[model samples]
Target chain A: MIQQLNDSTSEAIQQLNDSTKMFNLYLKLGFEHLLDLAAYDHLLFVIALTVVYQLAEWKKLLILVTAFTIGHSITLALAVLDVIQFPATIIEWLIPITILLTAAYNLWTLSATDGDSATQKTDLNIKYFAALFFGLIHGMGFSNFLKSALMPGEEQQIVWQLLAFNLGIEMGQLVIVGMVVLINFLVLNFLKVNKQNWIKIVNTLVMVFCIWIIGGLLE
Target chain B: MIFFLQILSLWLAHDIHLTKAQVDVNTSEQSVQVSMHIFLDDLEKVIQEETGFTEKMHLGTEKEVPEGDSLLAVYLRSHFLITANEEPLSFSFVGKENSQDLLAVWCYFEFPLSDISTKKLTLTNNVLMELYNDQQNIITLVGPNKKRDYLLFQVDEATASFSY
Candidate 1:
């Protein structure tokens, strides 16, 4: 007769090592997904999301990024597990549309007074949830690669991998957002470019890119 | 966004072109580490079918499946057989890992030894064969001298002998 193979002691000891491996593998996958040239749609979307925020407002940026992470993880888990299957076609189209909308929002709100602390507070509340909401659609866009790369495992294990991968994506997005903020600081603070003009220039470029994507998708 | 990739995985998995498993031997440690990776959905179906267990076993959660681990171990032992110097060797269950990249769960197993005076072994891996007619299990055996031998096991012929 075969003895009990999995000892509790061994299981306890191996948990840390096993979890570390899990984090490294999924984290790498998540980071690479955002950086992939094929997933330029994703890269551009994240850029559009963060283009308006400056690095000095690190606290607000962190919250906004977290909200986006939460939103994507929900749909990513739902879609990949086959619990909520929407036609991937619709998602593909909507991803570009979403980017267009976000860039347009920046243009529409460009003149909103950032100097007023009260207005800034209210604006943040809106943008925080906005990132969360749009992030759901981006999650769908992210699902295919995620589905292909993930190895289906136990239910608990799948959840952990999903979280780990999402964390990885967030890390990549943070890096991109960081660079954007840093560049804006240098251009506005050091280079002495007009803050308003700088914001307009960046958002205009983002808007143009979004329209190009939408045009291609429609064709 | 392209549909071809999704369909491709399905056909390939069914055609025995993509599902994979691996193992590596450590001669100095007098041991071997085994990892078998299988799709979660596919694995769940097979486990449910073979054991006739009604409840689904969640990978990392506390969802209880009484005897799930034991049943899993039995199935693993039966499908994955190891021999040293023509003598049967039992495996000690290590642990398991789930990879989102592979959409598969990897269960770990190992065998301990005192020393490696000789390195000749046999391995039999037939995991997921019943469900996947095209399943392939790849075994890589390493010796103390850093030498390596490989075997690609297929349906109906799932065992290989290696000399290091």
Candidate 2:
């Protein structure tokens, strides 16, 4: 009877050990949602992009987006490898500055041009380059989030987890961009509002929001 | 004016204790002597009436001195007096060879120790010291041990006592 009792106790202990292992595995896998949530900055960036939708040529827009993707991807990989670290405060301040500059540019172009011909000639090359530069800073921000969350110990599992989180962020960004594009298309086809007026209102609102964020940072 | 007043009040009130020495478990010798000097002027009349009969009062009723470095920690907690939110204070434990005592407490505040104003620290009293742990969570105070020596003072009479 004592032997039987001992065997049952051992079995219970084994079951508990298995449960704890399963719970740890769940935590490691469940970290994808945290990465998805870090894409909050992309919301404002997409909203800012909406203002340029009517003005920017399809090819130019595609090129700008690709440049941003490449710049951020490069920095994200470098940062994760511990090749570089940027001051968190400076990066935070710069994000709002970038948005404000983009809005100012859009506002300046709209105000300076009178006719359709003049407005069509106005270029967004400088704004595209600015987006690419800011994207690097944004990538560093993402890398910081990942570093804190993963807490990379000697285990090989951390690297795998980091890769998974990065993939999740990319997937999240794609979903957001897709939704924005679909919404823009639907509004343009069905709503029949003047695109230029919409651009002005959106850019102005973005500039105001950016300024508020900057003020908060300064405080 | 308000800022200057605040600074002055803080300067007058804060109690800071500096560390004298620290010992680790592996390095401690067989026995260590700990000593704290209580100035007769800092005690209340009540405490003096209670413990004045003895020249040396030993308060370790449980016959347990904390193991190794824990003794140093207990000594620091017991010997030092601090009031909440006066000024940022720092402590350093200096190691010295003393034939009489294994542990010695020497404290100096940002302000003069004599400048400290006594306010009642009972739960019902308006003035109290709320101790917090490392996590910034409030530390719940347990019932006082009768064996430990308490420095009691009467502000109205400018008199004090030490009692066990």
Candidate 3:
């Protein structure tokens, strides 16, 4: 009786396996939504950029943004192709550091000069360059986000998904920049409260938060 | 740097089973014995050696474990599906023992099965076998066969379940 029961159970399991294989094949063949909600780092990058640049220079901002785009695109392609890789934990830590550094640079430039209009202009230009460099780091971080979404087996889907996600990122970034600009124009410029010191204080606080977050990530 | 080291050390200290396997058989008089082993290790070295980039240096404060257990429990619960019936199964670390360097997790289900068979279990794929369809059945088994003891069997009508 026991031997007969084992034989029947084995047969049942075999049939189940066969049916599951067929079902799985169908599941894999369909359109899989590879992209999830954008990573926190991606959101943080946009927020950090918006926070630092209160006075907007359109031309410089465009160039810096393009440089960032190119840098991340190159790295994403390289990383996905097995040409380059980093430990995920390390990358996670670097992401917040990039934000912290950008904020630090903002604070440093703002604090170094008195309330001279010319000094502010020069510092704004320095901030623009700093944004470009930081964009490069941020791009690497973005590639890491995209890499996880695009699996090895779905190589054919990589290019399209990459394009869509990058486009989405650009859209998200533009939206954030617009919001920041609008908020600054409304509160700082229109109100004309001479809140330059307040702005510096806010930036300092953001830097501290970024540092704390980085510490948490590293741990 | 210290923060990064702590993260790496925590990752290394915990066993991460990538693949596992088990088999079980029973008779009317024997008590069930479940034996399972999982393959887990820090793949950091492999990743670093292949990637040619060091992890980011973390110069931040250490984070305390929010809860009592290590971070591994949270990670596993989120990343892996460990279930009995339709409920999530809680796993406790049984410590490193028997030269295996593997963490053992124990849980019980109520059921009665004369015998159960399972195919090879793996992390990417798992084989689960449950016996008995009625509630309140009791199962008991003696020492597990060492050669194929990786399989775990439970005889609970309420909690016994299987998946492939």
TM of chain B vs. native, candidate 3 = 0.26
Best of the two (2, 3) by lDDT: 3
**Which candidate should be chosen as best, given lDDT against the real structure?**
1
User: What would the per-residue lDDT of candidate 1 be over residues A37-72, giving only the tens digit for each residue?
Assistant: 544677877777777778766787788888888888
Tens digit of lDDT per residue, candidate 2, span B4-115?
Answer: 6533433332111111111111112211122222211121121233334323221221322234123333334333333323431232333222222112222211112222
lDDT-better candidate, 1 vs 2: 1
DockQ of candidate 2, scored on C-alphas against the true complex (2 decimals):
0.02
lDDT of 1 by residue, B33-82 (tens): 77766566676667778878888776433563667567677668777888
Query: Lowest summed lDDT over 10 consecutive residues: which window, candidate 2 chain B?
Result: B131-140
- Which residue pairs collide in model 2, if any? B20-B94, B33-B102, B43-B160, B43-B161, B44-B160, B44-B161
RMSD for each model, in Å, please?
13.9, 19.2, 15.3
Best candidate, TM-score: 1
Where does model 1 sit among the CAPRI classes? incorrect
Report the CA-based lDDT of candidate 1 relative to the real structure: 0.69
lDDT of 3 by residue, A1-219 (tens): 999999889868765654443233222211111111213444555555555445555665566566666666666566665687755556566667777776666666666556688987787676666666666566555565444333223465455555655666666566656776677667777777455665576567667777766655545
Q: What is the lDDT of candidate 3?
A: 0.43
